[model samples]
Target: MIQKDSAMKLPVLFLGHGSPMNAVRDTPYSRNWRRLGQALRQRYGGEIRAVLAVSAHWCTDGTAVTAMPKPRTIHDFGGFPQELFDVRYPAPGSPELAAEIRSLLGGHAVAADFGWGLDHGTWGVLCHVFPEADIPVVQLSLNVNLDAPAHFALARRLAPLREQGVLIVGSGDIVHNLRLMDRRAPDEAGSAYEWAESARSLVNGWLENGDTQALTDEAAYPPALHLAAPTPEHWWPLLYAAGAAGADEPLQIFNDDIVGKSLSMTSVVFGHDALFEAV
Candidate 1:
C-alpha cells in the first residue's frame, strides 16, 4: 500500500482534455502535460498515493466509483487512428480508495463500480501526465440527476482526500461545443471565433476571480452558455475541481488556449505554486 502523509496535501487539477488524438500527438498541450507531471513528482517528491479522476465521459444515473483492481483501457471513442485505439494506459485501480470515496459521500448512494474502466477523458490526459501508469487511479462518475450546486456540494465532500495524498483530477473542457468546432481552423490561440473567445474569457474571469457562484449559475451566461457549453457534462467537471479546492488555496490557470474555434484548452491547478514554478 502507498503511504500517505497528512501534512502533504496534494493539489487538485482540472484538465481540459481536448481530444483523444492528444494522447498520441505531440502538441503544446501534451508537452505541457508532461512538464506538469515532472513538476508534480519534483514538488511532491513522488509521494502521490493515487489519482481520483472525475471525467466527462462517465455519466451515470447516480454517482459511482471504479473499484476493480485492474481497470481496462476503454477507447470510448471512434474515428480515431488504430494507433490511438491500441494505446493502453494500464494503470491499476484502488478498491480501497473507491471505498473511501463511497464513505466520504455516503449520503449520495455512490456505487462500487466494476463495469466501467478508464475512459479516454481520464487516460488521454494521464498518458501524458503519468505515462508510467504506475499510480492507482479511481474514477468517480458524474451523477446526471444532480444540479450544478449539488455537484459542487458533492465534490466538496471529496476535499479530505487531498490531505491523504490523493490527487483529485477533473478531466473535461471548459468550453466544449462539438457542433461549433471548426475542423479547418488551426489548433492555436486566437484562432477561435469571437463568441468562443468571449465565452472562454468570461469563464476565465470567473475562475480567476474565485467566483464559484457565477461559474455554477447556468443562467449567468445565457446566450453565451448556449454556444459555449450546450451540454453540462464537459463543463461540470470544472466544478468538481473548484469545489474540492480550499477557499484559501491559490488557483493557477494553464494551457489557456482555444483550439478548433470552439474548444477551450484551459486547465486549472489548485494550490502548490511551487509545482508551477518548477514547470
Candidate 2:
C-alpha cells in the first residue's frame, strides 16, 4: 500500500524555533535548519506539494487553518531587533490544501481562517528551511481548548496527507520557559539548566520508545516538567508530530542543544536519516 511505503510519503518534523531573531541571524540553529531543508529533497526524493504547519504562536479558540492566497509574515513577538522586525517571509498560502485539510478532518471542527497568517513560530524556521518561499504553506492553529491527547488525535487524522506530498511541521520548543533562564550564567550561549535537560531526557525517552501515553499522561513525568514547560502551548506541538509518526517509524533527534539556559533547540525528524547522517 502507498501508506506503508516511505519512498512516496513525506516525513514529519518537530522544530524547536527558539527566537524570532533566528529568522535573520546566521546562527547555528538557523544553519542547521537550512541544511535540513536541503537534505529533504536529496533524501526524500519527492516533490513537495505543500507545507502544513502547526505553530505554537497560533493558539486559537478552535482549530483553524490559514486559507489566504498570499499569507503575510507576522512578527508575533516583541522586543526583537529592528532588522528582525523588517524581515518578511513571502510564502504563499494554500487554499486548496486548507480545503483538503478541512475535508480530511471531518467532524473535527476545523475552520478556514483568512485573517491569521504565518507567525514567528512558523516563518522563523521556515525562512531557513525553504528560503525561496516558493512553496505554499497553510498554518494550522493549535486549539487552546484541547489537551495534548486531543492534539495528538487531531494530527493523526492528517497522516494520509503525508503520502500526498504535504510536509507536516510542528514548530515549538520541547522545553520553553523564558522566565527560568539564568542570565547570571557566564557564556549564556546554549547553556541548559539541569531541570531542562532532565525534562528533555524524560521526554526523549518517550519519543524514542514511541510511548505516546506516557508523553500525554500528566502524572507520568517528573517535576522537571514544570520547569521545562511552564505553559504547555510550546511543548504541545511535539505531540502533533508524535501522533503523525508511523507506529514503528524511525525517529532521530538533531540540532539538539539548549539555549538561554531553559529553552531547548532540539529538533527531530521521523522516517528520515539524512539530517542525522549528514552531520
Candidate 3:
C-alpha cells in the first residue's frame, strides 16, 4: 500500500528590514524585499491564500491574532514625517486564517481586538514586498516574555499553516541597536559598518551550521551583536523563522548589509525551491 504525502510547505522568512525610511526609499534592502515578493508570488501564485506577520512592532504578553475583516493602517513610529504617517496598506485581514492559526495552536491562541492594523514592522517591509496590498494579512503579536524555547515551540505550532498556503513573515532587524545608529552618516563609511561586517560573518557561520543553540545564546555572541541588540525583542523574530525550518537545512540569505550604522538588513529564507511549490 502507498501513502500520500501532504502538500509541500511554503518557505518561511525573517526579514531584517532596516529603517522606517526604507518604506519610502529605493535603497538596496527595500529593493531586495520587493524583488523577493515578486519571486514569491511567481513561486506560489494563486495558491497563496494569505499571510500572517509576526512583527517586532506588536508585543504582547501572549499570542494574539488580528482577526479584523479590514485592518487599518497604523503609523506606530514617532518623529517621522507626516508623509510617512499618512502612508497606508489597506490589506484585508484574514479571519479564516486567524481561526486556522488558533486551531493549529489549539489553546495557545488568543483573539485580538478587531480592526487591529498594520504597524511599521508590517508595512515597512510589506510596502515593498506586496506593494499592491493584494494579499489578506493578519498580524500576530509577539509574546515578549517567552524565552528561546517557548518562542521556538510557538513557531512549531505554526508549522501546519505552511501547508495551508500561508506565508509566515517575521519582520525585524537582525542588528537593531537603536542607540548606536547614526542615520546621518552614509552606510559604507562608518566604524559601525566594520562591526556589522564582523557580526554578519558570525551570524553567517551559525546560520550555515543550523546551530539553533548558538543562535539563541546571546551571551556567547560576538561583541558587534552585543552592541547591536541591547534587547532581543527585534532579534528574536529570526529565531521563530529558524525554528520553522528543517533542523539541518541551511538558511538562505536574501539581503545582508548594514545601514544607518546600527541596523543590519539581513533577510533569510528557511526552505528550498521544492518547498516553495505553487502554494
lDDT of each: 0.88, 0.84, 0.77
lDDT of 2 by residue, 204-252 (tens): 8888888888888866667899789889889888888888887578877
Specify the highest-lDDT model's number.
1
lDDT of 3 by residue, 1-279 (tens): 011134857788888877687899777777778778888888778656788888888888777889888999898878878778888999888778877777777777576658568888988899888998989998888887787678888888887677777888999877887776785774542356677667777876787788888887755777777766778778778777877776676557856677667778788888863322121
* Error of model 3, residue 114, in angstroms: 2.1
The C-alpha stretches of model 2 lying farther than 4 A from their native spots are: 1-7, 184-191, 276-279
- Residue pairs clashing in model 1 are none
The TM-score leader among the candidates is: 1
Of 1 and 2, the candidate ahead on TM-score is: 1
Q: Worst lDDT window (10 residues) for model 3?
A: 270-279
Report clashes for each candidate as comma-separated counts: 0, 0, 0
- Distance from true location, Cα of 156 in model 2, Å: 0.7
- Count of clashes in candidate 2: 0
Instruction: Report the poorest 10 consecutive residues by lDDT, candidate 1.
Output: 270-279
For lDDT, candidate 2 versus 3, the one ahead is 2
